[model samples]
Target: MDCLSLLEHVIVTLFLAVLISIYMNKGREEFFRILLLGLKSLPGMQGLISRVLKGEVTNFVKQVNLDETTKGGKRPPRVVIPKKGIPYDELREAMAKFKAAETNHVEGKIFAYTYTLFDEHFQLQKDCFKIFGEKAGYSENHDALVSLFHQAFLHENALNPMIYPSLRRFETEVVSMAAAMLNGNENATGFLTSGGTESVLMAVKTYRDRARKLFPHIKEPNIVAPITIHPVMEKAAHYFGLKVYHAPVGPDFRVDVQAMEKLITPNTILLASSAPQFCHGIVDPIDKVSELAVRRGLPLHIDACFGGFMLPWVEKLGYSVPDWDFRVPGVTSISADIHKYGYVVKGASVVMYRNEELRKHQIFTYAEWPGGLYGSPSMAGTRPGGNIAASWAAMRALGEEGYMSKAKELMEATIKLKDGIRKIPALEIIGEPCMTCFAAQSTDPEVDILAVSDVMETKGYKMEKQQKPSSLHFSILPHHVPFVEPLLQDLAKSCDEVKANKTLAKKGSAAMYGMVATIPDKAIINDFIVEFFSEVYKCN
Candidate 1:
């Protein structure tokens, strides 16, 4: 009787334990679900996720070894202000050593991240930067260089225009020049920004604010943009509490205007398209989109950041380009990077609006600050005067004639490169590219484009990999002009090698890219990328 009772009790105890464990697991799952929902509602959370997933966080971590922990348990050197300063020469030597590992972009082998120029033009910019480096536009220094800098910085932080009339004047002139090139009328007004990303951000922010004022009932403002529109637009939408409705693109990689129109709703605050999108370097149908915007009574923003400086000349050279600027009646704003094709050093772009009323929305001013009245035109608070000065100097130095000549050369080189690419039967251009920037895909299944990229890398050529339809992107610059034939030869060789060794597609970046591209659950991919970022940021 005692053994039977004990066995029954043990069985009951085991059953109770199993029941409890199941309930606890359910509770944990519910808790995680609630936590994830909360995280999704938070602003910039997706941005942080996207940044981590996009390899930016990993790239940053690779560039900086911030962790001090070491395997030997030794105290690592801390980066602190030295009690005694080192000699300038010694400091320079240290800096040179630090930079020794960086890619030699000047050699023209690298593409995707850099835009190089003629050595002489670069020298001119460097000299201008050095002269204006220390002087802020706020300073009253009236020397010619300072005066030029003052002009460049004037309207940038135009809250107090009286401080530097020259800055306002130069800024106006720069804006006017950009507007004229973009075919905008006298009503066009804009301000210089830090870069293309900032310019795009400002445009998004301005349109968002305008929508808030005009359509008060709209709770969730959204932007209609091509899938190929710069990712910065998505970032801007994330930061400003706007939703981005990405419209599908056609086989040409250009946004389908009808599909984009279908995505528009009453809450649609802005319509955007790229002038030669960054991925495939094909312009969206801005004319058709502009007509749609006009019909819908909405604002259209042309993100010509990459093509702003080059496309105008391309058109002037008798190349057929679609109407993409303010000349279109419905277009309200445009952002063009002076850094990309403008031949300006890496930190200047312009966002032009149809009128002052529209531009005012981009301005941020807080008069209630304890210190004093504070305001900012674009994203940054303390704008770099040197960037403005250098940009201005570059523009003025190049002039219309210089830019035209350079554009002609770049176009010719682009033609040569495209012609060479055509000669490679396995490789095909992604779309009908309108500018020097374009992408190419491997048509033959035996040759993986990503594998070709890896092979090209081994040949000392860096190429950008594009998804959707897997391909390789190239943005030709003055430096790339000389390397056009060489790049073509390398591309052909890489394609041949990849075609010969099908297994190469399963190695290096090709393997990673191919695997990620085929993954249905992007969350898993994002998690993996976030883990990569974590590993990259690990100091030890």
Candidate 2:
């Protein structure tokens, strides 16, 4: 065998040996768990897992939606109008009933939706959708059903961007907007991605590719980020074959720059800090990280998918926002989601680099394919034109002035709520969020935050609960701003009511969340997640 072939074989052998060693060291259970996680990272394995998860999630939704004891028990007509259409009024009544059932299921009841609950904001969104929905997808070039669908199709096949020029255009605009928001200049360039996860994936991939080209001798690539950095980085590391070195966070939930500095090694491809992490809405030390990256010749990525669109305005409105953008010298790339705070529909996000040179690492090229020569700037095969249009529309509609007003309203409401929550002795605000989204925990040992969340669920708040600290999350939207005081008042009352009341029977999906958190074996949790997907896809 040639030297290169022999070297590859040796590397594969070493990889296998390492796996075996880990399996031996950690025992079969832990080893298999990690191995399965590793398997899930593989492209083939990822697709399989995704399908399974989708199916399970679908089935779960069906079951919950059709639960006989609940209000939405009546199923839709099975055989879809095989005979003839019903009368107009009859059809309208049926539609209304169905709408009511769905509304009952969602109205002030679901926390995960992250929209305004029956307020002007909610009405405004509906009005926007109503006004735009019919006309939204009517582009002759691409007859998209929804604006989201259009965006979904913009580059649905990014593997062949030449075939879909619109995707390139959409991507270009998205990146330019993201970079401008992050203070990137003419030197900056970027691409559109599926979501925050894919954006993170591409950033890691780009850095790895750059490392491969520049420092070929460095075999092992590692990413350094705070513990609070979204798990997507870990997912990216796993998918692209890189190691993760976590830096600890302070009580304020911000990354410790000193600890991060100590963790950087010769193989470190990327340094990361969050504009504001998912769990707690606290921005990391981006300026410090950027300075460090510059000194070390490492590429630093600021993940602002959660806070990118909001923070800029927040900073402009005179909040204590830090320089977590391209303004920093070494800040190489940034990921921002137009879907989240951008108030556009989902399936839109951007990954931007400080300069074209660094961005070159993000492009994928293929010289050989049966169909044709293929190349893509981002990960996806196809892009969505409607989403791009909708996002662009959303941006245009909500210009700087509009966003500033929204930011101001949201900040005021958030501060009021934070102060109100702090007044309650049992519950404490998790961190000082610059914007609306924040987390809270129960200080009283007897009071389970999950239980409190369950109680809030009963009250129709539908807040999300978290583990690893056992807290509840709240993403305050512009819609929720007005209800902030009332929500806090209800929350305080809920705590009192729960404290005074008897232990009632557990009802609804809150129990499942609690159960998931308590499971000691992570494999079982994985199995449950897999099973959950299996259940989701069940039609009956």
Candidate 3:
């Protein structure tokens, strides 16, 4: 189209949008209420909208000290600090007030944080924080404290570990620990990265880079992964300019190994599987995929980020999990997160390979630079010392015995939660999930699972929702073991409330999710999410 026509189109669009905005603002109360009501009228939108609204209303009620009606409130939610620096004592008082305000949002109160906070353990962690935090904060050498205490002890960046001997040692130890956990032999070698996503990206990058080097005939590099593989692989493929081939999963939610085998082609560089996928927590058949990778001379990666730390202990505790780690013959690499189940502070994960030669492809090096020769093993250049230190501290504190015991408790809690959900006549658990994470689908198609989620939220339980099958999810933790009975009881009561009084669950984020799913144009939904992210970082 001509520039004139394009300008005319833009003006018309703007005019209509302004009219809609004015209408919406004029009927603001009606607009929001109806928007939520419309979402609840749809299936999955009810769950998402319900969660969001519950969060907003709960905060409103607490901050304003309002009753159920929210009438005649003295204070608003906004409380700002002074622009100028306060005296240390005044600052401490302000910090205490803020901490008190946040303390109300503690463990067993909500979900989504994922970490289990036991009363005794929470106190222990708090005390530990108080002790280590002050000293660490006051330390002269930022790098020295980090190097002394952290699990990944090296202060030097992994990008050019050769420049720093201590960092190289830390990196090697972390990788060795991960490989040993995965049943890798002497030949196995690996690298440390930021998190699970980076590990997955490097695996894709390594395979893609290797394909270009070895197979001159292959024009386009393609990766075949089960639908359950973390979205990171797909994202890496998009960013790195490679094609991704998805293999379907069985009703059990595990990857269909035969289907993946058939899909393998000359262009396929990496075969991917999750030890236990995110959605349903079902482990893919890595043995079959490993064999295929061997026959096809393709690299295979096992993503165990979710279940990594827990699974090792669970196996020791006597769970019949299949071999989905480095023990499997043709598996070239594995990615496992220490932060999640390892009870590490955060920002810790390990990516392992069969040999250092395979890992060399994952590294980025530069010989010519004004800043001198630069090389990084993973994505980030400057790593956080505090995170590394805290993670290492946490791991040492937990030890093998602590992890195993915690894993046992978590498994028991998961089983109890599963059983409780099964008893609810309206819902059916999706599959045999071996780990803490389990998903549920509504049997009565008319009754939205999101609606059930809304009811649960009012009772102070925050559950996650899922797409594709339209379900609600749970990720069990050690602290949850104590509250399993209460949680299950609440869930049962919520289910009853949902069935009897549909209006009770009629308000929240559930509505938004349901509405989004039914919308035929996914591009619009994607655009909305992207815009949401953009608006989040925009200056107020």
Candidate 4:
């Protein structure tokens, strides 16, 4: 070999040797994380990465309706406070005009985040909020008079419950009711959170604090959970300075219990599982994992954010739900959202613990300040009394029968939809989903699901595209039952159309999806998504 070539080989070898030493001493995850810090410094890498990401970001922005240029329509005025307020009628007109910009989701084609069923039940919440806001309920003994307080409770602060005793009652009752539904024992206690994310954050914080008190020697604590666990858990780890070890899911899309157990090290502070994971809608093998958690003497948190309200009813309906609740001995905590299937208004959830001992870690107290011996539960202060009131009122009104009825209808609709999808020649359900939510992927190699999604969009369905095995997400609601047959027909036609040409897969954001699938480096995809978000939020 030439002298120059021989010297290059020797330098590269020595550098690799140093990297190996760092990996052995500092650990694989940290070593790679540190190495990636200087990724932009590598010759030609930054430019290539940026170029690849720019095209993908442009595609994503356009796909989400952020068109590059305005043509015919006038821009909405970005209004600050006017010197004179716009009259009430004019303000109402502006509100209606803004609202008109959205798709007619009531047609049942758009499978968005919320799946509200009834206008009547929705009115109950509106009345309750107005009862708090303007000054309204489902009390078994008497009509829950929410309007008694008027705007007084709406303006009231929940931080000092002594002054706002009714809001306190609403919050505690909502928490207690959720605990009872999840089969939490008498000693089991918890606090109300703004939503599922906050509940998860608090749960993670509580467990981390507990580990600090118990295992003070472990400075760098970590959490072990299924790869399919909600991203909120990742958010918690990021905020709380905890490392995460995500165990891979099995072919069934359930977390492999053995793989998860292997990831649990001495530094692992907690274990997490989802009742039905968000990505594929498959429940992790929590029963087996709970046994491992018990063996390891580690806290296990079941995130039932999606299935929280429905699964209890599913069990009641004899739908073969796996054991994943407080009935299990090793489950130390659970995060359940009332906002979703609970049919309440937005932003209400419960974070439960086996007992107050563990929950005490989640409580924050400040005696050093002039704030006069403050103690707050969860991460939120100045809590909304309206959310609490609506949650309480809705749960009381619905009772078990109301929820059970809705759950049954939703299950029936989901089954019908799943059956229909199975009949489609080119499409198949992604996993053995535990609940009403599921995803559909291409059974035929020629059929690109993302391409099918673009077609479905043309048919007025707001289909969410999935990765890992390209699919389209479906979250079915009770009211969606009526549109099941129509959706199935459109889906079948879309699949057939996409499969026939194959070149159609190259059109629109399907090209973006194809590019994302081929790219081996995930950091580039991360950059693409970040850029997409930046473009999406820029003043239009």
- Candidate with top TM-score is 4
User: Which stretches in model 4 have alpha-carbon errors above 4 Å?
Assistant: 1-152
Among residues 3 or more apart in sequence or in different chains, the pairs in candidate 1 whose N, CA or C atoms overlap within 3 Å are 67-539, 151-166, 151-167, 154-167
TM-score rank order: 4, 1, 3, 2
lDDT of 1 by residue, 372-478 (tens): 77778888875655456545555555567767788899999998999889899899888899988889988898999999999999988777988888989989998
> Candidate 3 clash total?
26
Q: List model 4 lDDT by residue over 155-181, tens digit each.
A: 445676554455665676677778888
lDDT of each: 0.78, 0.72, 0.71, 0.79
Judged by TM-score relative to the true structure, which candidate is superior, 2 or 4?
Answer: 4
Error of 2 at 225 (Å): 1.2
User: Predicted candidate 1: what Cα RMSD to the true structure?
Assistant: 21.0
Score every model by TM-score.
0.72, 0.69, 0.70, 0.73
Clashes of each: 4, 37, 26, 5
Tell me which of candidates 1 and 2 scores higher on TM-score. 1
Candidate ranking under lDDT, highest first, comes to 4, 1, 2, 3
Q: 1-540 in candidate 2: lDDT tens per residue? A: 999999979976886787899888888887787678877866699779878987896677566543223347453221111112223344234333433443232335532312234567655554454324655534421112234334223323434433334444445555666666678776777777768888889999999999998899889989999998888998899999999999998878888888998999988888999988888888887888888988988889988999988998899899898788888888888898877887767778888888888888988888879966667777775555556655544554455776777788888887888888889888998876766678898898656666677677778887887876878888878679658767987888777765665352143344666676678898998888899899999999
lDDT of 2: 0.72
Cα error of candidate 4 at position 487, Å: 0.6
